[model samples]
Target: MSKRSSISRLPDEVRQHIEQRIAEGQMTLDELIHDLRERFPEHADDLPSRSAVHRYGQKLDRRLAAIRASTEAAKIIREHAGDREDARSEALTAMIQSELFESIMELQEASDEEMPAEKRVGLLSKAAKNIATLTRSSVTLKKYQEEAAAKARAELLAEQEERLEELRGEDGMSEQLEDRIRNVLLGKA
Candidate 1:
């Protein structure tokens, strides 16, 4: 087994406080050692070495980076999901408007006594064609949005899976337990 770190000898609370400060970029090793010496003179000899503290800081930075990437992936998934819903709603509205326009064209043709029969028919046909084109465009937009959302979700899952694999390789833990830990760390659990 590997030797235990000297920093591990410190109380959990103290260790966490030191790590938190390091992670927040609030203190460098020299600064931390000086502050510790000043604040807790009694434990001056027990303070961690500069290299140990630096290693801990680097580890914390990696964890923070992983967490941020996971959060950004989730945000992308949510945005794409919202876009898909918006596309579907727009398509539905377009279809409804097309039907309404067609109905209005028929009513206008029947009610306008001054308009010639051939001219009225031509105008009605043109309006109907325009509405059909809009409806088709909406349908196409909805399909594209659906595809984008699916792609986003798939990419996010793949990225999380890769990160989990890397964590597993580094940790050498049981797959099931590592998965649980990964979920908890990523806030999925």
Candidate 2:
């Protein structure tokens, strides 16, 4: 296994401090490292160099940016989508499928000589199986959404029919008119 980074070996409080400082975007790598050493003298040796700090900072920055982006996306989805769990789930699954597709394409482009044939084949096989499973999941979600919607529509129609029963012959409404309304609502007219 690869050795862990010196920064990774830092104490929890120090690591949290570094992560917070990095996230705040106000500290340079040199400034952050200097401050870390000064603040945590006993564990200064565990602190990373500027380059290592830079690498870790970049990784953390990307993660924080992704989180902010996702937060913004969720806010937008909530504002417009309005409790649309199925739409969100479908969109998330699509995004995952797209990422998997790109990764598989990259793997396909890599030569077998770069990796052992069996290992590469195994990876591809796993990818194919995942794609199949994801597709099946998408199909199942669609069917579930459809079934739930149909059930809801049936319930609403039943309630409407009950109201129609109550309204029969009231306000000069006839059975013929109610039948017409029911047929129109049912798309059988």
Candidate 3:
């Protein structure tokens, strides 16, 4: 049977705490190690090596960066929502293309020279296609959401009209009763 790595064996809560600390950038690696040792004295010997912690921190940072990028993209798309359709599409396409270019540059820099040329080309092609698809999807998604919202608004209005009609019918009957009462009181019934 395979044994779990020290980092993997740590409780989820502990790992989460470490990741949070790493994300905050409030402490150095040595300080982080010391703090963990102090906090989990019982498992001090079971803690991951400094290098493992550093790797984990790097991975966490990458994930966080990706999330931030996605959020920024979403914000950009939403900000263009009130624009004309063509304007919105152009804005989205520009934004996505710029991001894709930056991502390709970063990937090229990070990729090892040992990586196959074919694989690299394939990756770039896929990324370009993905950016194009994302640009198209963003516009389509906004249209669908707007349609759904309008439909919901229409349904709500219909329901309200039905309710108002029922209230108006009751109001009319009440008025008729009041008129009859007035006639009887005047000895005209």
Candidate 4:
């Protein structure tokens, strides 16, 4: 009944192109279909209806929203990437701590003086395994935290160093004079 319904169907390529233009926010669905009818009158009937185009547009809208959310998530990831990894490692280590390891540590404390040599040796070996697990996990967590902290500090220092260089360049300080001022500045101000 509509002007578009009078002619033969349009090709998938043109329909897709129409959708692309709509997704680009370059035109409304009605305008797109109307223009398609005008541009390719022979395929008017095949061209998508306004409602169909609108449904496709809704899909595009949802896709755009998802893209926006992921972009925001990526920014958050970049802002806390190092700290997040360290926190994860620490959390996992804390969660994995076993009763066995705790008992081992307690045994070592208890055996400091009076435990017999034979019993002490057996208990110590078992305790050593448990303690090693704890120690290794603790050391790993510590190293991760340390490495993350060092990386953050290095990045901060690099940025400060870049800013300092920019300042020096802006003021046209000579190479030797820059070093002299840098020595007096004491690391990063």
Candidate 5:
């Protein structure tokens, strides 16, 4: 297997600093490298070359951009669509499904020589578990929604029955009339 990039092997705090500098949109790769070397003098020789830093910075920029776009899209959805019928959750589920598909495709195309057999199997197993979990959660959500609708319908029927009793007592309404109303409301008429 190819060795990991030098930047990838940097300490967590240094990586976070690099990511922060990239996000701030204020520093060129050379400047960032210079700053890193100045701050971590002991690691000056270990720091990656400019091209490596640029590649890492570009990847981080893409990730940050994706995050910004996602946040903006969610804000617009909330403002206009308001998550009615749990649309937000549905959107997130679809996003996850798309990501899972992409991950599976990547795994399928990955070079066997570059990755170990056991690691590939582990990744595939994890993907399968994710799919199963997502399916189970979706089914549970649908069942919960159905139960909620049934409960609401039952409450409406009870309210209607109470109103019918009032009419029967005060107006002496006929039993046939009440039966007709019930049938109509239940869509049996």
Candidate 6:
């Protein structure tokens, strides 16, 4: 394929430069927006059109660049900072762990706090206890409820089957009746 056949392609050097800017956090959404405005100076004349296309496109480009940069940075960090004890790495690790610990403690404290009076009373009252007792009464009660419902469904199904059987029997019964009626009204042949 001819090199010119490739559509809207950036040179490798330009692509690398952009990727580097992203990794260094220099190519942010805000920076992209500012750069776009500076480059496309006429875009601000019509607010609506600019807002729809120019602004949104700039924002999207910035977000994509930031994501690329972050991925590249993570790769670089993993490769260069492997098992190293740099001050920055230690600080980041300590900060993350402390934050996690604090969050866990806060959650535990929330769970241990006395519940609201209304909720506590609802769960622990004599009436609530009685209801709980009734609900928990023999496993057979629960089983029986399910069984009774199933039995009712089976009874309805059996009734339908019986009705279908009666209808089928009537087909023969009808033929017998017709023969008897013909014999009575117009004598036997």
TM-score of each: 0.40, 0.62, 0.44, 0.36, 0.70, 0.21
Runs of candidate 3 with Cα error greater than 4 angstroms are 1-5, 82-189
The digit string of per-residue lDDT tens for model 6 on 98-153 reads 54456444433443234454654554464445545444543445565567668867
**Rank ordering of all candidates by lDDT, starting from the highest:** 5, 2, 3, 1, 4, 6
- The digit string of per-residue lDDT tens for model 2 on 101-179 reads 8887777777756666788789889988999999999999899788878887889899988877777755668768878
Displacement of the residue 145 alpha carbon in candidate 2, Å: 1.0
For candidate 3, lDDT tens digit of each residue in 4-37?
Answer: 3567779887787798799899999999999999
Backbone clash count, each prediction separately: 0, 0, 0, 3, 0, 0
TM-score of 3: 0.44
For candidate 6, what is the TM-score?
Answer: 0.21
Residue 94, model 5: Cα distance from true site in angstroms: 1.7
Clashes in model 5: which pairs? none
What are the clashing pairs of model 4?
A: 8-46, 9-46, 10-46
Which residue pairs in candidate 6 have backbone atoms (N, alpha carbon, C) closer than 3 angstroms, thus clashing?
none
Residue pairs in collision within model 3 = none
| lDDT pick, better of 2 and 5 | 5
RMSD of 3: 14.7
| lDDT tens digits, residue span 1-189, model 1 | 133576778878667778768877977789987776787677778888888888877877887896687567556656776544454456456556866676665547564455667776787687778778777877777787788779877888788878777777854879788779778756799
* Residues 22-96 of candidate 5: C-alpha lDDT, one tens digit per residue: 889798888998999898888777878999888888888887887788788888888996644455566677778
Best by TM-score: 5
* Total clashing pairs in model 4: 3
Comparing 2 with 3 on lDDT, the higher-scoring candidate is 2
* Shift in Å, residue 118, candidate 1: 95
